[model samples]
Target chain A: MEQSTESDICTDPVIRDQWYPLRALAELPEGATHHTRLLGVPVSCGVTRGRPWARTESAPGDGGTGALPVIDTYGYLWTSLGEPPPGVFEIPEYTEPDRRSMNAGSFIVATSAPRAVENFLDMGHFPYVHTGYLGIEPHTEVNPYDVEIIDGEIWATRCEFFQPMAAATATGGQMSKYTYRVPSPFAVMLYKSSPVDPERRDVIALLLQPMGHEQVVAHNFLCLLDDVNSDAEIKRFQQIIFAQDKPILENQIPRRLPLDPRAETPIRADHTSIVYRRHLRELGVNYGVVPA
Target chain B: MIRLYDWELSVNCYKQRLLMALLEVPYEIVPVDFFPGWEHKSPEFGRINPLGHIPVLDDDGFIVRDANAILVYLATRYDPTRTWYPVADPELLALTAQWLMFSEGTTNTASAARLHDGLGYDFDVEACRAGAHRLFRVLDEHLWFGEREGRHWVCPSPHPTIADLAIFPDVALSEEGGISRVDYPAVRRWMDRVRHLPGFVGMPGISPPLATSPPSVG
Candidate 1:
């Protein structure tokens, strides 16, 4: 399987445009309640509950005069279900870049977390935010250097070491296990190759969704685990994994934080951190001493 | 048989139960306990509703999740008389839909928050109170000056429709959260008319469901 840079969204024009308006509007008071032209069409901002109007100065031309738009959320229900007006919003059409191909082993992706993606790219303040976790590491230590471009996909290498010593007296058997941490905090992907296909490996994509400001929804998408299955089984598994993450993340206070990559030291164990930070730097985001 | 996943104490849930009772439809009640998490976040229950919210009615096999959906579904499916819900009139349906949205979008959340906060259940009182007042002012301004002779709220002609059935309970119970329901005389009177309907069943403040639970079908 090919490894790809996770922070690709920063360079993606579609993501930047869609995210900017929402981020801007969410900050505005009653912003959720206002009728605004999103991409040049009047779309009801029902989520924020008119916070934008409350915060900003509404001039005479604006609807916030003595006559505020009916401000009825009921009307929004119809708008949400109906088709978008023609030419109302510009839909950016971007295709995935072509990648160079190579004869490789079968790759199985494991459970991955989205929060990890959010944390990795966020290089402004991680040391303080996730003090005990992957925070406050020196820039050089967390750098990704073994960059290789294969079929338009990026792959990097780092030496991973593990201590091994375990024996069961009852069965007189020895147990050996190796754990691999992904550059993303969202998951720890361990590659397992079957005996027949020694070069083939599987990956896990663990997802972590911060459900609310203080809550999180985490799940592991075990790709290439089994062949296509029944929808019922798939739905059940998804619900179970999603449900497990709901309570754990919900109870966490201050669920998210900005990542800062300075004022901290990195040990040999910081191999994954290096690759992750390099990926963030490539996207022109903040990387500690480097300001963007 | 129609089965309602409802909490008797909930005015929102009560709307469906009242509709079922008034329509005289035989159904079963599956009580949901908000305390020990009987229905809210259970995985088994989550399959029934991905959002993990309540007042789900299973009419035979067809399911209606939200209270407003349940009200509309029951009225359309069972009430042939159309006395409770007139299906033919678009204006009436639209008006009813409008108020139902008001009740759910405005009144329900605010009033319930007041109840939860006032009754010592964990809820934000200041936020909830402000929300309650915001909605109350709208309802009051409309009720205080709007045209009304001696009929219930938006029943159209001299009687209560499904709209009234939808709005009446929450408006009446708004006071339980320390809200001055008496401020809006029109709303208060409308509340009385709704309560006095034949076969009317009050929430009775949290009761245990019987072995043979009553169905909450319209």
Candidate 2:
């Protein structure tokens, strides 16, 4: 128990004081309460009167700091362990009625939340990890991408890669354009070209719910303009791609994402990951990160 | 056409699929909803194989149940060279059978732990993991020594046999059950050897190493 407690996600202000996804809205039944760990503290969450809420058990003499605020938005129940930002970061495309917003799937990954986020930011692994779907070798090189913090959010633009079967709607290989956003340490989103609706970018967001410093429940949410494929097929395609990444992510040398510049070698293609790690450092995020 | 009652994630089922793929034996998949659906345990499936397990192969109505049994049947019937089953050489045949038997230990321990975590089965996970680690240690030692003897596979054969495929899934996907292979370098190298084999196909949680840059199959 002591070891488990010690290994739970660090509880520093920057890492803990932000909203994290608890579960998808579809899975939550109204009026049920249960406790689950968040940033190392057990918080009870339930839906009441169609409003999801979360609260923690405060010991005596701790005052009234037990009520952790909860909000339901974009098909998930979100809660904060401490002070969250003004609102859950903006996702303008989700409001479009024709755009289908859905849950791709959720997986329990035995690595730090940051590792999962970094994997989303990486396209070099696509040729290898995602294989034929997102990329294939001989065409494996990732074109130069721009990474910078815009208004305090990490953004990577101008990223592109060639993929065989880019999506459920993909009929053949295409040079897929990619844009990435890291709104927080554990959340990353990708805007890739919609194979069916080439004019519109498909949104795939991976949010990490940190169960511990070295473990997380990764929730994949998709907002896409694709009407050619059924929801089930879309989910299946995303799940297959993610399943391939699972083995590689789990087999990484260290379970925690190393923030130290010298810890892991970086190449030109890892520009986004390198920038994201720097952003994490700027935020003073030590949870789920290797000590320098 | 041969039909296999298969689940993509099951190591036992995957071995049959892997062997068939390696043998280049084109077959149809009778997808069994083994997880949330539990179709394999149904009365209808019970008629196919009373054991209520998957990887039950029906080759033109000749039914073969169990993973190893199907492997034995396929290698004997399909391989013209007969290098896989080695029926002609008694010594190699005994060694192949020995490793195939050892593969079951991996299934019961490592794969059982995966079932508990991934599919929510009732299992003593700690015990399962401990048993798996014990088996992996012995496996690592064996592979390490075999490399020294210039034997690339579990069986001391010039070519890989059914035993390699049988054990590959359980050992490769051990991390799905939180069993890390970091300590077993020799075992890791052996899995890579299996992955680089022509016609190698990966199920969920298994993929060829990125450096090998092989295969379009995800």
Candidate 3:
């Protein structure tokens, strides 16, 4: 006999509060065809087998988008593969062109604006959260020089030579000077400041959207001087950067309570954060601060 | 061979199924029984997932678990060149991820709570109500701010992405779960764009799957 417990799958300490077994709610005897309504949506209890397939629906032309709505079908069997379930569709392996790769002097990383800005400014987090990844010197500074809002999107300027950043700039080194535009507060854009002579320049762009508060969808884009360029190296580089950001960013709790201001200590290192926080406060945006 | 562990009426499961249909991927379906505690805890079933959850996908030899992860894998590995996975800026990707998280983590929770409580399930009605209120309020605020900026809730792009696909089902079905979506006109408009997608799928009326008679294990 096989038994499934809520504890086995739902590892999240918080989610466990509502982790009742589907079987408990279904009211059917053990070893029967099981089904339960989770959050009001109907689903078979559990078990999976056979190849994947969709439930049959009428052809779209038969009526319209309103008719013949789509649905999924599940059947359970067995398998020897130790592979995990498919979370998203897969992309076929392909050989990318070199000129389009990182050799083209462009790279892209996709992450949320909050996480991105925090990473750029919070030197203390890098050493701990992104260990063996980025280092910061004791005297590192993240000075904000300018802030602008064009058509509802925000662009800010900061001078940073925290660590490897200095080395990257010394060699014809441009700091991470880029324009960040949030078309909607939910999405953010970061691209190199250099222009392509009244048209374009080497650019790396990332788009982040929320799947849910805890989960997010991110994609990487490598924009180049020429639209026809191709490169596998840049793609690999972009993916590596994404992999690096994933662990740290995902670990951040979006809704954590704010620290106590009265008992708090402020220092010179927090000058940049204070300025940014005050600006947002002036705009009446609640950056997770509690009232005194 | 493609094997899918899915429930017939789930919007999240439909998300994956819809993609397969749009991409014309061939797959075999496996039905799991959730009612009588049969499939979920069977020794045979436990082998696939000890958690005993549905919406599991089994590829030729590889298995992908989470619904969003499966969607990302499909768009990337199967339809990389398709407009579905745009070759835009990294911001677009971040923007999409943000919405996906909102749908699955926030909207889904509220929507589900409304359904369970409204439909007479053993739900914590007060808790559900409070949760829904908080979640919808954030969305309402975002929309209010968006309107001030001459935009709706769409991300930073001129077009839509998987972000929209990720959120549409829950937002549309929210009304069925006892939510008064009329208050959020912007969300309604945002849903209109989602409905117009090339291969959009809508949630169906709530009803249990077929009731099969018992079979003897002896």
Candidate 1 lDDT score at position B152: 42
Model 2 off-target regions past 4 Å?
A1-3, A7-9, A25-36, A43-68, A85-87, A95-101, A225-233, A251-255, A258-268, A290-292, B1-10, B27-104, B115-123, B137-163, B176-193, B203-218
Writing each residue's lDDT as its tens digit, candidate 2 over A58-105 gives 423333446778888889888887788767988999999999887776
User: Candidate 2: what is its chain A TM-score?
Assistant: 0.93
Give the DockQ (C-alpha) for candidate 2. 0.19
For model 3, what is the alpha-carbon lDDT of residue A40?
A: 17
Tens-digit per-residue lDDT, B21-107, candidate 3: 666777776655432223556677778878765568888878877777777777777775544555456766776677677777544
Candidate 3 structure quality by residue, lDDT tens digits, A147-231: 5666544555453333332111122323334444443332244444332222323344343322222222343434443333123
Give the TM-scores of the predictions, in the order they appear.
0.39, 0.76, 0.38
| lDDT for B181 (candidate 2) | 94
Task: Give all candidate RMSDs, comma-separated.
Answer: 19.8, 5.5, 26.6
Report model 1's TM-score to 2 decimal places: 0.39
Query: Just chain B of model 2: what TM-score?
Result: 0.95
Per-residue lDDT of B98-165 in model 1, one digit per residue for the tens?
Answer: 87888775455565664453223455655665676777667766654544444345646554678777
Which has the greatest TM-score?
A: 2
- Tens-place lDDT digits, model 1, residues A73-97: 1011112111222221211111112
Error of 1 at A162 (Å): 74
What fraction of native interface contacts is shared by candidate 2? 0.19
What is chain B's TM-score across the candidates, in the order shown? 0.83, 0.95, 0.76
Scored by lDDT, model 2 comes in at 0.82
